[model samples]
Target: MAPYPPPQEAATSTLAERVGKGPDQNPNDTITTSPNCNPNGQESPTGKKTQASPTAIPEIQWYYGKHESRIAYWLLLSGAKHFGYYPRGTFNPFPITSALRRMENEILQCLSLAPGSRVLDLGCGEGHISRYIAREGSFPLVLGLDITASHLAKARRAISGDVLRGFLRQGQVEVRLGDYHDLFTSGTGIKMGEWDGVTAVETLAHAVDTKLAFSEVYRALKPGGRFCFNDYRIGIPDDVVRNESDGEVDEKELSPQQRKTLKAWRWVMRTGGMKGSEYSYAGTYERLLKEAGFVDVKVVDLSENMRPMARWFWILSLLPYAFAKLFRLEKAFYNSVSMYEQYVEWGGWAYCQWSATKPAT
Candidate 1:
């Protein structure tokens, strides 16, 4: 383990630039949250850290806010541990499983793991990508960290029973409870600059403190360690969903159909806990990585390639949405439908694959 340099005594302007108040700000400070963001989950009414008994575990608002936890639960119930990357119609000759596996392979290639290299799978829900890394022998040591207990449980169970069990026994695979915001912090038990590379795989969205998460990743990686991820983020402004540039939105120029789509889009974002107020655009992600000392930042828009998957989800969700609408119980269903439709349309949001690296001395 290596010690981090002392915190720079800079102005807190960068922290307040996005979410108001720095990470070290008092609990009493007015911290802006997304729509429907749970106040109880942020801090106690007395502005003190909320604690729970052994029998009661306190929930942390990661990602799309409170509704995010529900989405995880539904994913588990649907037997889905992670989202799969799909090729566009041009590249759809192979089956989806093949395409997804191919995507996984590409991610590993981007990571470029060396022999006996240590890797961290940040926000590794159920360890899907982590298991793939072990099974593929991409790294001799792989650490999967997630805040979700149930996901970690499943990740451990799945890894132990799979053929990759040898890797687990060999000390090559381990899953631990950790918040991305606190990746290199002392309490996380992860060594700073210990990893050869890190893969987030659509995980940074769950970060409560995006700046801190990026800074921690920059700190945790060995110099020249690569960081890569696939993420869906805000591509356009909420008020003006179409014809946008530089994160600006104009309400007066939107078409009627666009406005309808925009409304549904907002619902999906709000319920998904995205809220668009933070660094939702692809540019914002690249900027953060650079600000955190990552170099050679690359952002590839994969929205079109993801259309096939979006279409599949839209079809699959129809049955449930229909049933829920018929019964007047379409709260979550409506959101799901909206999400799938917006994905198919590929507007107001973007699915992107990004890679960057810590500068080698």
Candidate 2:
């Protein structure tokens, strides 16, 4: 296998140039450097100028840093943070490892990149799917990026183990601290049109600015490159009304039950560091992708394939949720709350996979 290429030199292009936008377009958009590095920037070992790391959001840090959250994810999902995909007509959700791999395989199929493709995995938790793509899909290099420090630490250790065991060549897969919103910025070391494929698994919903995030991904991909991801979306109720000027939901129009369910759902999203309103409806994603200059967009509802696993989570979380509620410790058990609200109580959430292509021309 070919060795991983050296990091790209920091480009001199302005944000508008990098994103193929005119100076007046998106004038309000801003670039933020990452956290934990020098404010003045420093030179990398590769002689590239590296800037500060992306700022880590407090909610993400709090949620992933909790011992209970870590234990629950490991115990239930076996360290795969995303939902599993069961075969159609299958009632059982056990043997979760297989189902998780199936979901990964589905992503690989959606990507359909040639061997030796350069790939980027955005919001990669623990680098499981990144490594899977490198190993099973024969991608020469897979760079996994995430904002959470704890998740990156685990991902690095797992990559190290894979290398030591001779299951993967050194540097076939790597994890870095990065924010999806800052992809084309200097500090992140990601250049425009740098990747043949880019993927986000349950990732983009956490983006603070969905439009900026989508634009960054579109800017970072090579022409004709594919972007695919699976994420959560809320079902908009028929009676809900939207503001005509900005198209935002009108809270006053929500029925009492709808409001309550939305509150619970938003709380769950906040625990994962996402603004629920931004990703509430499926149409939002499709419209945003088109606005970002992507073409051939497709969305598939995978909710049925994920129902068994959701049901399992709802079942397993019941006891712990009751205990947490009794003690008023629901914050520590937010995952349980997510399961209860998503599967059992509200049932307005859907699992969806989306794919889009950068226009070849």
Candidate 3:
């Protein structure tokens, strides 16, 4: 065989094949995992820079706080690997695969971005959305910030050679590692103002203080500049489900099983070097945005039209997760499995992408 061709599919697969196994795998294992899509069979706890963080990762409030959850962060990285990525959903006539594009387009349309609008992506994972807007849409600038150095490394690497001067044209979308929740207090140290718009995507709820995060975003934007995002965040109070929360994890209304699953996820986050807080699926985000002084908030149903896909994707993504919870393998195999699943070629989630504005003068 004259040098087997190559994966040529993705950099990740090719990189995975470079060594006998993944970076976390042991060299002692003789069994090869190349053919297996789930290649984490031999992965083990990599004591790789696990000093923990203080306010980033939500599980361990100690030494390994957020600094240890590198695996969980890969979930976001997988999405950013592709510019036109849609979180697979189950809705028909517009299944998760099809509707995701429509959903992103709807959100962009709702924002009414101009030819050269400036946008900011808070917690911009791998800067994929910003990359799309910058390279494809020709935006003026799209700045992204995060708290983890590893994520920033991947993002910076993805931006790659000449990305600043070439593909993006204006060389916009600078991805820096910083804490969005406390940017204002810390004073970003960069020239303030000149921001045309802002976005958070699926990252705002991670802040220990959602109100503070929105407030910072409010302070960062130019008047009338639009701010938008589409995350599985909490909606305004309505005829959904009754809630009686003091904003604590222990007081939520989810089933015991849900709580257990969430806890398991958090544990993995700590081990993998990512940041997350309690599930904000029930918090009052609409009211907080209003309180933060954002005008013309549009919390549309990103999932209503995709109910079918939501149900299907929920099964594909969450069933195994539920099983992990039941078997206590969440920390063992589930962590890697869930991380890998996040990279599945396609999925359908009744996702919500919201658009809000800063009141034009």
Candidate 4:
């Protein structure tokens, strides 16, 4: 994909001009301070007081900080750390970089923010999506928050490079080391109704309390502001589906193969620092968004768009995964296991994009 224009050039273009009209929009690290903001909650160059650094979750740090995990993300994903979106009818995954850009465009469209809007990107791993929003120029001020120090270091370096190259304004994009849950708490300086839009891409799944996280995002958004995100939802077999609040699968109903898949799924989620039960139900997101006072909630299934990339990962992992299993190196190849389980055992997974608006009143 072509590089985005410098901030000055981008400012002269309309959003439509920057993002072509189409579904297919052809587009990791150690602890460090954000480019334009102190990671320790100091006042930023833009005069915005950032939140205090939240205690990093050890599981998350251990997982993403692993040598194998970093290499896998960099080699396969170019440090994007998210799935790509192949347009419907385009099953081939060769153009994965473009597909990844399309997925970012999807999120941008869902946000639908006006020029100069302020956005908060939770779990802004490597700050890829956050920088994308800034480069689009619609949201000139994009603040990224992530708990991982290594990822923040990488984000800082990238943002600094962009600023130095004039690709971004000095303080147009700033990332801080913080947690989404503490976004609106006292002393954090993140005021209620402060953000024009908030985005979390595949990050909320790691929140131990998804409802609390939703509430925090709702509080942080301005009245009538939008919250948009992409995440995974567990799919239940029709025969075993029930209206259970916890959304736990009934192990007894599963065949041995299904049981094995579930075990692998759990392992993947656990190792990835995700709260599996929070994502085990389809309607959990809608319910939580409503409970958090968001209106006009909408959820779109993007499973088909995600399938190509999942399949791509599965194919890439086969040989390595076989060796992993042979040598009991499965833990080192947890990402491979995740792809395999999600692709072959997709009956238990669903990829979704969701949007909800804070009530205007």
Q: Write the per-residue lDDT of candidate 4 for residues 323-349, one digit (tens) a residue.
A: 888999887887776677678777666
* Model 1 spans > 4 angstroms off: 1-80, 90-96, 163-169, 237-262, 275-279, 323-328
lDDT for residue 285 in candidate 2, whole number 0-100: 79
> Model 1: clashing residue pairs?
64-273
lDDT of 3 by residue, 162-275 (tens): 353355433355566555654532323333355677777666535544555676677777788787876543222222334422243432655565545555444534444334
How many clashes does the backbone of model 3 have? Answer: 25
lDDT of 4: 0.73
Candidate 1 or 2, higher TM-score? 2
Model 4, 93: alpha-carbon shift in Å? Answer: 1.6
Cα deviation of 322 in candidate 1 (Å)?
3.7
lDDT of 1 by residue, 1-361 (tens): 1121232222323322321222432212222332112323444223533222111122223332246345634542232344455645553423655545556666787887775577888877777678676557445567777766666677777767653334343344667666565554323456678778888876665454455567778878999898988776665434443433334456467666655655666565554444322245537777778888899999887777766666666666777667766787645465455545575556766777889999998
lDDT of model number 3: 0.48
264-288: candidate 2 lDDT, tens digit per residue: 7777887767652434574777878
Models 1 onward score TM values of: 0.70, 0.81, 0.60, 0.81
What's the true lDDT of residue 115 in model 2?
80
Give the C-alpha miss distance for residue 79 in model 3, angstroms: 4.2
C-alpha positional error of residue 283 in candidate 1 after TM-score superposition, expressed in Å: 1.0
- lDDT (Cα atoms) of all candidates against the true structure: 0.59, 0.73, 0.48, 0.73
